[model samples]
Target: MNLALTVLNITAPVFLLAAVGFAWVKLGFEYRVEFVTRMAMTLSVPCLIFVALMRIEAEPEALAALSLAALSAYGIVMIACFALVKVMRLDVQTFLAPLIFGNTGNLGLPLALFAFGEVGLGYAVVVFAVMAMLSFTIGIWIVAGRGSLKRVIQEPLVAATLLGGVFLWQGWQTPEFLTNTIDLIGQMAIPLMLITLGVAVARLETKAMALAGFLSLIKVVICVGAAWLAATFFGLEPVAAAVLIVQVATPVAVTSYLLAEKYGADAQPVAGLVVASTLLSVIALPLILAFVI
Candidate 1:
Protein backbone atom coordinates (compact mmCIF):
# COMPACT_ATOMS: atom_id res chain seq x y z
CA MET A 1 0.00 0.00 0.00
CA ASN A 2 2.75 2.43 0.90
CA LEU A 3 4.73 1.63 -2.24
CA ALA A 4 1.69 2.08 -4.45
CA LEU A 5 1.03 5.45 -2.87
CA THR A 6 4.66 6.39 -3.27
CA VAL A 7 4.53 5.62 -6.97
CA LEU A 8 1.33 7.58 -7.38
CA ASN A 9 2.72 10.53 -5.49
CA ILE A 10 5.75 10.60 -7.73
CA THR A 11 3.78 10.27 -10.96
CA ALA A 12 0.68 12.34 -10.28
CA PRO A 13 2.10 15.81 -10.74
CA VAL A 14 3.72 14.90 -14.07
CA PHE A 15 0.52 13.64 -15.68
CA LEU A 16 -1.57 16.31 -14.01
CA LEU A 17 0.53 19.10 -15.50
CA ALA A 18 0.39 17.37 -18.85
CA ALA A 19 -3.36 17.08 -18.42
CA VAL A 20 -3.53 20.82 -17.79
CA GLY A 21 -1.88 21.42 -21.15
CA PHE A 22 -4.09 18.86 -22.84
CA ALA A 23 -7.16 20.48 -21.35
CA TRP A 24 -5.88 23.92 -22.27
CA VAL A 25 -5.66 22.94 -25.91
CA LYS A 26 -8.96 21.03 -25.95
CA LEU A 27 -10.73 24.09 -24.60
CA GLY A 28 -9.55 26.09 -27.64
CA PHE A 29 -6.75 28.11 -26.11
CA GLU A 30 -3.81 29.36 -28.09
CA TYR A 31 -0.47 27.86 -27.03
CA ARG A 32 2.34 28.52 -29.42
CA VAL A 33 4.31 25.29 -29.26
CA GLU A 34 7.24 26.42 -31.37
CA PHE A 35 7.90 29.48 -29.29
CA VAL A 36 7.56 27.64 -25.99
CA THR A 37 9.82 24.88 -27.25
CA ARG A 38 12.46 27.34 -28.43
CA MET A 39 12.48 29.16 -25.10
CA ALA A 40 12.61 25.96 -23.10
CA MET A 41 15.35 24.45 -25.20
CA THR A 42 17.43 27.58 -25.67
CA LEU A 43 16.99 29.11 -22.23
CA SER A 44 15.28 27.25 -19.42
CA VAL A 45 16.43 23.68 -20.05
CA PRO A 46 20.04 24.71 -20.46
CA CYS A 47 19.86 26.50 -17.17
CA LEU A 48 18.41 23.44 -15.51
CA ILE A 49 21.14 21.17 -16.83
CA PHE A 50 23.92 23.54 -15.90
CA VAL A 51 22.62 24.05 -12.39
CA ALA A 52 21.98 20.37 -11.79
CA LEU A 53 25.40 19.33 -13.00
CA MET A 54 27.21 22.14 -11.28
CA ARG A 55 25.66 21.31 -7.94
CA ILE A 56 25.40 17.51 -8.19
CA GLU A 57 26.56 15.86 -4.95
CA ALA A 58 27.53 12.51 -6.36
CA GLU A 59 31.13 11.46 -6.78
CA PRO A 60 32.67 12.26 -10.15
CA GLU A 61 33.40 8.57 -10.72
CA ALA A 62 29.73 7.67 -10.28
CA LEU A 63 28.64 10.31 -12.77
CA ALA A 64 31.28 9.10 -15.20
CA ALA A 65 30.07 5.53 -14.85
CA LEU A 66 26.48 6.62 -15.43
CA SER A 67 27.54 8.58 -18.51
CA LEU A 68 29.27 5.58 -20.10
CA ALA A 69 26.35 3.34 -19.15
CA ALA A 70 23.95 5.74 -20.83
CA LEU A 71 26.03 5.85 -24.00
CA SER A 72 26.23 2.06 -24.12
CA ALA A 73 22.53 1.64 -23.51
CA TYR A 74 21.62 4.11 -26.26
CA GLY A 75 24.01 2.51 -28.73
CA ILE A 76 22.50 -0.88 -28.04
CA VAL A 77 18.99 0.49 -28.36
CA MET A 78 19.82 2.15 -31.70
CA ILE A 79 21.18 -1.04 -33.18
CA ALA A 80 18.26 -3.11 -31.90
CA CYS A 81 15.69 -0.59 -33.15
CA PHE A 82 17.33 -0.55 -36.56
CA ALA A 83 17.04 -4.30 -36.81
CA LEU A 84 13.43 -4.24 -35.62
CA VAL A 85 12.48 -1.61 -38.19
CA LYS A 86 14.09 -3.61 -40.96
CA VAL A 87 12.33 -6.77 -39.89
CA MET A 88 8.95 -5.06 -39.81
CA ARG A 89 9.76 -3.39 -43.12
CA LEU A 90 8.79 -0.01 -41.72
CA ASP A 91 10.15 3.22 -43.10
CA VAL A 92 13.51 3.66 -41.39
CA GLN A 93 13.35 7.42 -41.69
CA THR A 94 10.02 7.56 -39.90
CA PHE A 95 10.10 4.82 -37.27
CA LEU A 96 13.67 4.11 -36.23
CA ALA A 97 14.44 7.32 -34.37
CA PRO A 98 11.14 7.30 -32.50
CA LEU A 99 11.79 3.76 -31.35
CA ILE A 100 15.34 4.49 -30.26
CA PHE A 101 14.92 7.81 -28.45
CA GLY A 102 12.48 8.21 -25.55
CA ASN A 103 11.11 11.38 -23.90
CA THR A 104 13.88 11.72 -21.31
CA GLY A 105 13.56 15.44 -20.73
CA ASN A 106 9.84 16.10 -20.53
CA LEU A 107 8.94 13.03 -18.49
CA GLY A 108 12.08 11.43 -17.11
CA LEU A 109 13.59 14.36 -15.22
CA PRO A 110 10.55 15.17 -13.12
CA LEU A 111 9.93 11.53 -12.28
CA ALA A 112 13.49 11.18 -11.04
CA LEU A 113 13.22 14.36 -8.99
CA PHE A 114 10.02 13.26 -7.33
CA ALA A 115 10.99 9.65 -6.85
CA PHE A 116 14.59 10.03 -5.67
CA GLY A 117 15.11 13.74 -5.08
CA GLU A 118 17.98 15.95 -6.17
CA VAL A 119 20.56 13.20 -6.60
CA GLY A 120 18.22 11.33 -8.88
CA LEU A 121 17.72 14.50 -10.89
CA GLY A 122 21.48 14.75 -11.25
CA TYR A 123 21.69 11.18 -12.51
CA ALA A 124 18.72 11.73 -14.82
CA VAL A 125 20.40 14.81 -16.29
CA VAL A 126 23.41 12.73 -17.30
CA VAL A 127 21.25 10.29 -19.21
CA PHE A 128 19.20 13.09 -20.75
CA ALA A 129 22.32 14.86 -21.95
CA VAL A 130 23.65 11.71 -23.58
CA MET A 131 20.32 11.17 -25.32
CA ALA A 132 20.17 14.79 -26.48
CA MET A 133 23.63 14.62 -27.99
CA LEU A 134 22.77 11.51 -29.96
CA SER A 135 19.30 12.73 -30.92
CA PHE A 136 20.61 15.98 -32.35
CA THR A 137 23.35 14.22 -34.31
CA ILE A 138 22.45 10.65 -35.25
CA GLY A 139 18.72 11.05 -34.80
CA ILE A 140 18.72 13.95 -37.29
CA TRP A 141 20.76 11.88 -39.69
CA ILE A 142 18.26 9.04 -39.55
CA VAL A 143 15.42 11.41 -40.36
CA ALA A 144 17.07 13.70 -42.90
CA GLY A 145 19.69 11.38 -44.47
CA ARG A 146 22.50 13.66 -43.36
CA GLY A 147 23.76 14.87 -39.99
CA SER A 148 25.12 18.31 -39.25
CA LEU A 149 27.89 18.55 -36.69
CA LYS A 150 27.67 22.30 -37.07
CA ARG A 151 24.09 22.30 -35.81
CA VAL A 152 25.04 20.15 -32.82
CA ILE A 153 27.90 22.52 -32.03
CA GLN A 154 25.54 25.48 -32.01
CA GLU A 155 23.01 23.93 -29.59
CA PRO A 156 22.69 25.67 -26.21
CA LEU A 157 22.11 22.35 -24.50
CA VAL A 158 25.47 21.13 -25.73
CA ALA A 159 27.18 24.24 -24.44
CA ALA A 160 25.50 23.85 -21.08
CA THR A 161 26.49 20.22 -20.78
CA LEU A 162 30.12 20.98 -21.58
CA LEU A 163 30.20 23.92 -19.19
CA GLY A 164 28.54 21.94 -16.45
CA GLY A 165 31.10 19.18 -16.80
CA VAL A 166 33.89 21.69 -16.44
CA PHE A 167 32.34 23.07 -13.30
CA LEU A 168 31.86 19.63 -11.86
CA TRP A 169 35.40 18.59 -12.70
CA GLN A 170 37.01 21.74 -11.38
CA GLY A 171 34.87 21.79 -8.21
CA TRP A 172 33.96 25.34 -9.10
CA GLN A 173 30.93 27.29 -7.96
CA THR A 174 29.30 30.25 -9.61
CA PRO A 175 28.79 33.41 -7.55
CA GLU A 176 25.87 32.98 -5.18
CA PHE A 177 23.67 35.59 -6.84
CA LEU A 178 24.31 34.22 -10.31
CA THR A 179 23.57 30.66 -9.21
CA ASN A 180 20.34 31.74 -7.62
CA THR A 181 19.24 33.57 -10.77
CA ILE A 182 20.05 30.57 -12.98
CA ASP A 183 18.31 28.22 -10.56
CA LEU A 184 15.23 30.40 -10.67
CA ILE A 185 15.16 30.20 -14.46
CA GLY A 186 15.85 26.46 -14.31
CA GLN A 187 12.73 26.02 -12.20
CA MET A 188 10.56 26.80 -15.24
CA ALA A 189 11.89 23.93 -17.30
CA ILE A 190 9.92 21.01 -15.86
CA PRO A 191 6.41 22.47 -15.88
CA LEU A 192 6.94 24.02 -19.28
CA MET A 193 8.15 20.73 -20.76
CA LEU A 194 5.34 18.70 -19.24
CA ILE A 195 2.70 21.14 -20.44
CA THR A 196 4.26 21.28 -23.86
CA LEU A 197 4.15 17.50 -24.05
CA GLY A 198 0.45 17.52 -23.30
CA VAL A 199 -0.17 20.30 -25.80
CA ALA A 200 1.68 18.40 -28.50
CA VAL A 201 -0.29 15.23 -27.87
CA ALA A 202 -3.56 17.13 -27.87
CA ARG A 203 -2.78 18.60 -31.29
CA LEU A 204 -1.50 15.37 -32.88
CA GLU A 205 -3.59 13.21 -35.18
CA THR A 206 -2.97 9.51 -34.67
CA LYS A 207 -3.17 6.85 -37.37
CA ALA A 208 -2.58 3.09 -37.28
CA MET A 209 -3.17 2.82 -33.56
CA ALA A 210 -2.64 -0.92 -33.47
CA LEU A 211 0.79 -0.75 -35.03
CA ALA A 212 1.83 2.14 -32.86
CA GLY A 213 0.81 0.35 -29.68
CA PHE A 214 2.76 -2.73 -30.65
CA LEU A 215 5.82 -0.68 -31.45
CA SER A 216 5.49 1.19 -28.17
CA LEU A 217 5.39 -2.05 -26.23
CA ILE A 218 8.47 -3.23 -28.03
CA LYS A 219 10.25 0.03 -27.34
CA VAL A 220 9.66 -0.19 -23.61
CA VAL A 221 10.88 -3.74 -23.47
CA ILE A 222 13.98 -3.02 -25.50
CA CYS A 223 14.86 0.11 -23.62
CA VAL A 224 14.40 -1.49 -20.23
CA GLY A 225 16.50 -4.48 -21.18
CA ALA A 226 19.30 -2.44 -22.71
CA ALA A 227 19.49 -0.06 -19.78
CA TRP A 228 19.47 -2.90 -17.29
CA LEU A 229 22.32 -4.64 -19.05
CA ALA A 230 24.41 -1.50 -19.25
CA ALA A 231 23.77 -0.53 -15.65
CA THR A 232 24.72 -3.96 -14.40
CA PHE A 233 27.83 -4.05 -16.53
CA PHE A 234 28.89 -0.61 -15.34
CA GLY A 235 28.06 -1.33 -11.69
CA LEU A 236 25.85 1.75 -11.23
CA GLU A 237 24.63 2.42 -7.70
CA PRO A 238 21.02 1.58 -6.93
CA VAL A 239 19.53 5.02 -7.48
CA ALA A 240 21.55 5.62 -10.61
CA ALA A 241 20.49 2.27 -12.02
CA ALA A 242 16.85 2.98 -11.29
CA VAL A 243 17.11 6.44 -12.87
CA LEU A 244 18.74 5.07 -16.01
CA ILE A 245 16.10 2.39 -16.42
CA VAL A 246 13.24 4.82 -15.99
CA GLN A 247 14.71 7.43 -18.32
CA VAL A 248 15.51 4.98 -21.10
CA ALA A 249 12.12 3.28 -20.87
CA THR A 250 10.17 6.50 -21.21
CA PRO A 251 7.76 6.72 -24.15
CA VAL A 252 8.42 8.06 -27.63
CA ALA A 253 9.13 11.77 -27.56
CA VAL A 254 6.77 14.26 -29.28
CA THR A 255 9.85 15.59 -31.01
CA SER A 256 9.85 12.44 -33.14
CA TYR A 257 6.53 13.40 -34.66
CA LEU A 258 7.70 16.95 -35.29
CA LEU A 259 10.85 15.72 -37.01
CA ALA A 260 8.84 13.39 -39.22
CA GLU A 261 6.58 16.25 -40.24
CA LYS A 262 9.47 18.56 -40.97
CA TYR A 263 11.32 15.98 -43.06
CA GLY A 264 8.22 14.67 -44.87
CA ALA A 265 8.47 11.13 -43.51
CA ASP A 266 4.92 9.95 -42.79
CA ALA A 267 4.15 12.26 -39.94
CA GLN A 268 0.76 10.74 -39.24
CA PRO A 269 2.17 7.35 -38.32
CA VAL A 270 4.86 8.92 -36.18
CA ALA A 271 2.17 10.93 -34.47
CA GLY A 272 0.35 7.70 -33.77
CA LEU A 273 3.49 6.29 -32.16
CA VAL A 274 3.90 9.36 -30.00
CA VAL A 275 0.33 9.32 -28.74
CA ALA A 276 0.17 5.58 -28.22
CA SER A 277 3.48 5.40 -26.41
CA THR A 278 2.63 8.36 -24.20
CA LEU A 279 -0.73 6.91 -23.20
CA LEU A 280 0.87 3.56 -22.56
CA SER A 281 3.34 5.27 -20.23
CA VAL A 282 0.47 6.35 -17.99
CA ILE A 283 0.38 2.74 -16.86
CA ALA A 284 3.84 1.63 -17.89
CA LEU A 285 5.93 4.22 -16.05
CA PRO A 286 4.17 3.80 -12.73
CA LEU A 287 4.55 0.04 -12.85
CA ILE A 288 8.21 0.39 -13.78
CA LEU A 289 8.66 2.81 -10.93
CA ALA A 290 7.09 0.39 -8.50
CA PHE A 291 9.52 -2.29 -9.56
CA VAL A 292 12.57 -0.07 -9.67
CA ILE A 293 11.82 1.81 -6.48
Candidate 2:
Protein backbone atom coordinates (compact mmCIF):
# COMPACT_ATOMS: atom_id res chain seq x y z
CA MET A 1 0.00 0.00 0.00
CA ASN A 2 2.76 2.42 0.80
CA LEU A 3 4.57 1.68 -2.42
CA ALA A 4 1.37 2.07 -4.38
CA LEU A 5 0.66 5.37 -2.65
CA THR A 6 4.13 6.63 -3.39
CA VAL A 7 3.67 5.79 -7.05
CA LEU A 8 0.36 7.62 -7.13
CA ASN A 9 1.70 10.66 -5.35
CA ILE A 10 4.57 11.05 -7.75
CA THR A 11 2.63 10.35 -10.94
CA ALA A 12 -0.78 11.90 -10.28
CA PRO A 13 0.17 15.54 -10.72
CA VAL A 14 2.41 14.79 -13.61
CA PHE A 15 -0.44 12.93 -15.24
CA LEU A 16 -2.93 15.69 -14.55
CA LEU A 17 -0.63 18.39 -15.84
CA ALA A 18 0.09 16.44 -18.98
CA ALA A 19 -3.64 16.07 -19.52
CA VAL A 20 -4.16 19.76 -18.99
CA GLY A 21 -1.49 20.53 -21.54
CA PHE A 22 -3.04 18.08 -23.99
CA ALA A 23 -6.50 19.53 -23.47
CA TRP A 24 -5.28 23.10 -23.80
CA VAL A 25 -3.79 22.34 -27.19
CA LYS A 26 -6.82 20.39 -28.29
CA LEU A 27 -8.89 23.45 -27.44
CA GLY A 28 -6.25 25.97 -28.58
CA PHE A 29 -2.53 26.95 -28.27
CA GLU A 30 -1.41 24.30 -30.73
CA TYR A 31 1.73 26.17 -31.69
CA ARG A 32 3.09 26.02 -28.18
CA VAL A 33 3.14 22.21 -28.37
CA GLU A 34 5.40 22.21 -31.40
CA PHE A 35 7.76 24.68 -29.81
CA VAL A 36 8.11 22.58 -26.68
CA THR A 37 8.70 19.38 -28.65
CA ARG A 38 11.37 20.98 -30.81
CA MET A 39 13.10 22.44 -27.80
CA ALA A 40 13.00 19.16 -25.88
CA MET A 41 14.04 16.76 -28.62
CA THR A 42 16.87 18.82 -30.07
CA LEU A 43 18.46 20.25 -26.94
CA SER A 44 17.23 19.29 -23.47
CA VAL A 45 16.83 15.59 -24.24
CA PRO A 46 20.44 15.04 -25.33
CA CYS A 47 21.75 16.86 -22.30
CA LEU A 48 19.52 14.78 -20.06
CA ILE A 49 20.84 11.57 -21.60
CA PHE A 50 24.45 12.64 -21.29
CA VAL A 51 24.03 13.54 -17.67
CA ALA A 52 22.18 10.33 -16.86
CA LEU A 53 24.90 8.24 -18.43
CA MET A 54 27.62 10.09 -16.58
CA ARG A 55 25.95 9.77 -13.22
CA ILE A 56 25.29 6.02 -13.43
CA GLU A 57 27.71 4.26 -11.06
CA ALA A 58 28.45 1.06 -12.90
CA GLU A 59 28.61 -1.80 -10.40
CA PRO A 60 29.27 -5.32 -11.67
CA GLU A 61 26.16 -7.06 -10.29
CA ALA A 62 23.62 -4.33 -11.05
CA LEU A 63 25.22 -3.76 -14.41
CA ALA A 64 24.80 -7.42 -15.23
CA ALA A 65 21.20 -7.38 -14.09
CA LEU A 66 20.51 -4.32 -16.17
CA SER A 67 22.07 -5.88 -19.24
CA LEU A 68 20.08 -9.05 -18.80
CA ALA A 69 16.84 -7.15 -18.41
CA ALA A 70 17.55 -4.90 -21.38
CA LEU A 71 18.47 -7.72 -23.67
CA SER A 72 15.51 -9.80 -22.58
CA ALA A 73 12.89 -7.01 -22.85
CA TYR A 74 14.13 -5.45 -26.06
CA GLY A 75 15.42 -8.49 -27.83
CA ILE A 76 12.23 -10.42 -27.28
CA VAL A 77 10.03 -7.50 -28.31
CA MET A 78 11.89 -6.90 -31.54
CA ILE A 79 11.67 -10.55 -32.51
CA ALA A 80 7.97 -10.72 -31.69
CA CYS A 81 7.31 -7.59 -33.71
CA PHE A 82 9.11 -9.02 -36.69
CA ALA A 83 7.05 -12.17 -36.58
CA LEU A 84 3.88 -10.12 -36.04
CA VAL A 85 4.25 -8.28 -39.32
CA LYS A 86 4.32 -11.50 -41.29
CA VAL A 87 1.51 -13.06 -39.29
CA MET A 88 -0.73 -10.03 -39.62
CA ARG A 89 0.10 -9.72 -43.31
CA LEU A 90 0.68 -6.02 -42.85
CA ASP A 91 2.80 -3.60 -44.78
CA VAL A 92 6.21 -3.48 -43.16
CA GLN A 93 6.54 0.27 -42.92
CA THR A 94 3.05 1.04 -41.63
CA PHE A 95 3.02 -1.74 -39.04
CA LEU A 96 6.66 -1.82 -38.05
CA ALA A 97 6.82 1.71 -36.67
CA PRO A 98 3.80 1.15 -34.48
CA LEU A 99 5.16 -2.06 -33.00
CA ILE A 100 8.76 -1.10 -32.34
CA PHE A 101 8.99 2.68 -31.96
CA GLY A 102 8.52 2.94 -28.20
CA ASN A 103 9.20 6.19 -26.33
CA THR A 104 12.01 4.49 -24.44
CA GLY A 105 14.19 7.56 -24.17
CA ASN A 106 11.98 10.58 -23.63
CA LEU A 107 9.07 9.32 -21.53
CA GLY A 108 10.63 6.02 -20.49
CA LEU A 109 13.76 7.66 -19.13
CA PRO A 110 11.83 9.95 -16.79
CA LEU A 111 9.66 7.12 -15.54
CA ALA A 112 12.79 5.12 -14.79
CA LEU A 113 14.08 8.07 -12.80
CA PHE A 114 10.85 8.10 -10.85
CA ALA A 115 10.81 4.37 -10.12
CA PHE A 116 14.45 3.33 -9.76
CA GLY A 117 16.10 6.69 -9.39
CA GLU A 118 19.50 6.81 -11.09
CA VAL A 119 20.28 3.16 -10.45
CA GLY A 120 17.15 1.91 -12.17
CA LEU A 121 17.55 4.42 -14.97
CA GLY A 122 21.07 3.28 -15.69
CA TYR A 123 19.71 -0.13 -16.65
CA ALA A 124 16.78 1.35 -18.52
CA VAL A 125 18.98 3.69 -20.54
CA VAL A 126 21.30 0.92 -21.64
CA VAL A 127 18.29 -1.05 -22.84
CA PHE A 128 17.04 2.06 -24.60
CA ALA A 129 20.40 2.53 -26.25
CA VAL A 130 20.24 -0.98 -27.69
CA MET A 131 16.70 -0.44 -28.91
CA ALA A 132 17.62 2.91 -30.41
CA MET A 133 20.37 1.40 -32.48
CA LEU A 134 18.14 -1.39 -33.74
CA SER A 135 15.20 0.96 -34.30
CA PHE A 136 17.13 3.69 -36.09
CA THR A 137 19.37 1.68 -38.37
CA ILE A 138 17.56 -1.57 -38.93
CA GLY A 139 14.16 -0.07 -38.25
CA ILE A 140 14.66 2.74 -40.72
CA TRP A 141 16.06 0.39 -43.29
CA ILE A 142 13.12 -1.96 -42.98
CA VAL A 143 10.64 0.92 -43.18
CA ALA A 144 12.35 2.63 -46.09
CA GLY A 145 12.73 -0.81 -47.77
CA ARG A 146 16.02 0.33 -49.22
CA GLY A 147 18.56 2.67 -47.71
CA SER A 148 22.30 2.80 -48.07
CA LEU A 149 24.51 1.33 -45.37
CA LYS A 150 25.91 4.80 -44.85
CA ARG A 151 22.47 6.27 -44.32
CA VAL A 152 21.66 3.68 -41.71
CA ILE A 153 24.86 4.29 -39.76
CA GLN A 154 24.79 8.08 -39.98
CA GLU A 155 21.70 8.98 -37.93
CA PRO A 156 22.26 11.64 -35.25
CA LEU A 157 21.25 9.45 -32.29
CA VAL A 158 23.32 6.56 -33.62
CA ALA A 159 26.34 8.78 -33.84
CA ALA A 160 25.66 10.07 -30.36
CA THR A 161 25.50 6.51 -29.03
CA LEU A 162 28.78 5.58 -30.66
CA LEU A 163 30.52 8.70 -29.37
CA GLY A 164 28.93 8.46 -25.96
CA GLY A 165 30.00 4.83 -25.61
CA VAL A 166 33.58 5.83 -26.26
CA PHE A 167 33.34 8.55 -23.65
CA LEU A 168 31.95 6.15 -21.05
CA TRP A 169 34.52 3.52 -21.88
CA GLN A 170 37.36 6.01 -21.62
CA GLY A 171 36.43 6.71 -17.96
CA TRP A 172 37.21 10.37 -18.49
CA GLN A 173 35.50 12.23 -15.69
CA THR A 174 33.05 14.91 -16.71
CA PRO A 175 33.90 18.09 -14.87
CA GLU A 176 31.33 19.26 -12.29
CA PHE A 177 30.94 22.58 -14.04
CA LEU A 178 30.03 20.82 -17.29
CA THR A 179 27.59 18.40 -15.64
CA ASN A 180 25.96 21.33 -13.81
CA THR A 181 25.52 23.22 -17.06
CA ILE A 182 24.10 20.16 -18.78
CA ASP A 183 21.74 19.47 -15.90
CA LEU A 184 20.48 23.06 -16.02
CA ILE A 185 19.80 22.70 -19.73
CA GLY A 186 18.57 19.11 -19.47
CA GLN A 187 16.01 20.01 -16.82
CA MET A 188 13.96 21.40 -19.66
CA ALA A 189 13.29 17.96 -21.20
CA ILE A 190 10.09 17.14 -19.29
CA PRO A 191 8.19 20.39 -19.81
CA LEU A 192 9.35 20.67 -23.37
CA MET A 193 8.27 17.10 -24.05
CA LEU A 194 4.83 17.68 -22.54
CA ILE A 195 4.15 20.79 -24.58
CA THR A 196 5.31 19.06 -27.70
CA LEU A 197 2.84 16.22 -27.14
CA GLY A 198 0.04 18.71 -26.68
CA VAL A 199 0.78 20.50 -29.95
CA ALA A 200 1.19 17.25 -31.82
CA VAL A 201 -2.09 15.97 -30.45
CA ALA A 202 -3.88 19.07 -31.66
CA ARG A 203 -2.67 18.51 -35.22
CA LEU A 204 -3.74 14.86 -35.47
CA GLU A 205 -6.60 14.05 -37.83
CA THR A 206 -9.63 12.27 -36.42
CA LYS A 207 -9.29 8.99 -38.29
CA ALA A 208 -5.54 8.82 -37.72
CA MET A 209 -6.10 9.44 -34.04
CA ALA A 210 -8.48 6.49 -33.88
CA LEU A 211 -5.95 4.21 -35.52
CA ALA A 212 -3.27 5.37 -33.15
CA GLY A 213 -5.53 4.61 -30.23
CA PHE A 214 -5.93 1.10 -31.53
CA LEU A 215 -2.20 0.67 -31.83
CA SER A 216 -1.74 2.07 -28.36
CA LEU A 217 -4.02 -0.60 -26.97
CA ILE A 218 -2.06 -3.25 -28.78
CA LYS A 219 1.21 -1.82 -27.53
CA VAL A 220 0.11 -1.90 -23.90
CA VAL A 221 -0.79 -5.57 -23.95
CA ILE A 222 2.22 -6.63 -25.94
CA CYS A 223 4.76 -4.57 -24.01
CA VAL A 224 3.57 -5.61 -20.58
CA GLY A 225 3.20 -9.29 -21.31
CA ALA A 226 6.41 -9.55 -23.24
CA ALA A 227 8.53 -7.60 -20.78
CA TRP A 228 7.25 -9.38 -17.69
CA LEU A 229 7.53 -12.84 -19.20
CA ALA A 230 10.95 -12.11 -20.57
CA ALA A 231 12.18 -10.85 -17.23
CA THR A 232 10.83 -13.83 -15.37
CA PHE A 233 12.05 -16.37 -17.88
CA PHE A 234 15.48 -14.78 -17.88
CA GLY A 235 15.55 -14.81 -14.06
CA LEU A 236 16.27 -11.14 -13.50
CA GLU A 237 15.90 -9.59 -10.05
CA PRO A 238 12.54 -7.95 -9.44
CA VAL A 239 13.67 -4.32 -9.40
CA ALA A 240 16.00 -4.65 -12.35
CA ALA A 241 13.41 -6.47 -14.35
CA ALA A 242 10.88 -3.78 -13.51
CA VAL A 243 13.10 -1.11 -15.04
CA LEU A 244 13.36 -2.98 -18.29
CA ILE A 245 9.63 -3.56 -18.36
CA VAL A 246 8.95 0.11 -17.63
CA GLN A 247 11.07 1.23 -20.53
CA VAL A 248 9.32 -1.20 -22.86
CA ALA A 249 5.87 -0.40 -21.49
CA THR A 250 6.10 3.22 -22.58
CA PRO A 251 4.09 4.25 -25.60
CA VAL A 252 5.61 5.00 -28.95
CA ALA A 253 8.68 7.20 -29.02
CA VAL A 254 8.09 10.90 -29.74
CA THR A 255 10.78 10.55 -32.37
CA SER A 256 8.76 7.97 -34.31
CA TYR A 257 6.54 10.59 -35.94
CA LEU A 258 9.53 12.65 -36.95
CA LEU A 259 11.27 9.66 -38.49
CA ALA A 260 8.11 8.64 -40.31
CA GLU A 261 7.54 12.19 -41.54
CA LYS A 262 11.12 12.72 -42.61
CA TYR A 263 11.14 9.53 -44.65
CA GLY A 264 7.53 9.75 -45.76
CA ALA A 265 6.76 6.41 -44.13
CA ASP A 266 3.07 6.93 -43.32
CA ALA A 267 3.36 9.82 -40.92
CA GLN A 268 -0.32 10.19 -40.06
CA PRO A 269 -0.79 6.89 -38.26
CA VAL A 270 2.63 7.18 -36.70
CA ALA A 271 1.76 10.57 -35.26
CA GLY A 272 -1.51 9.26 -33.90
CA LEU A 273 0.25 6.29 -32.31
CA VAL A 274 2.61 8.64 -30.52
CA VAL A 275 -0.28 10.51 -28.93
CA ALA A 276 -2.28 7.43 -28.03
CA SER A 277 0.70 5.59 -26.62
CA THR A 278 1.72 8.56 -24.49
CA LEU A 279 -1.71 8.63 -22.88
CA LEU A 280 -2.09 4.90 -22.57
CA SER A 281 1.38 4.47 -21.14
CA VAL A 282 0.30 5.95 -17.81
CA ILE A 283 -2.13 3.12 -17.18
CA ALA A 284 0.12 0.48 -18.71
CA LEU A 285 3.20 1.44 -16.71
CA PRO A 286 1.59 1.27 -13.29
CA LEU A 287 -0.01 -2.07 -13.98
CA ILE A 288 3.31 -3.53 -15.07
CA LEU A 289 5.09 -2.05 -12.07
CA ALA A 290 2.51 -3.59 -9.79
CA PHE A 291 2.97 -6.97 -11.34
CA VAL A 292 6.73 -6.93 -11.74
CA ILE A 293 7.85 -5.20 -8.57
What lDDT does the true structure give each of the candidates? Answer: 0.95, 0.68
lDDT of 1 by residue, 219-290 (tens): 999999999999999999999999999999999999998888888798998999999999999999999999
Q: Can you write out model 2's per-residue Cα lDDT over 172-274, one digit (the tens) per residue?
A: 5578898799889988876666545555655665346676677678767777778888777767776667877777777887567667777778776776677
- What candidate 1 gets wrong by more than 4 Å, as runs, is none
* Model 2 lDDT-worst window of ten: 155-164
Clashing residue pairs in candidate 2 (N, C-alpha, C atoms within 3 angstroms): 102-253, 103-253
Best-fitting candidate, scored by lDDT: 1
TM-score of each: 0.99, 0.82
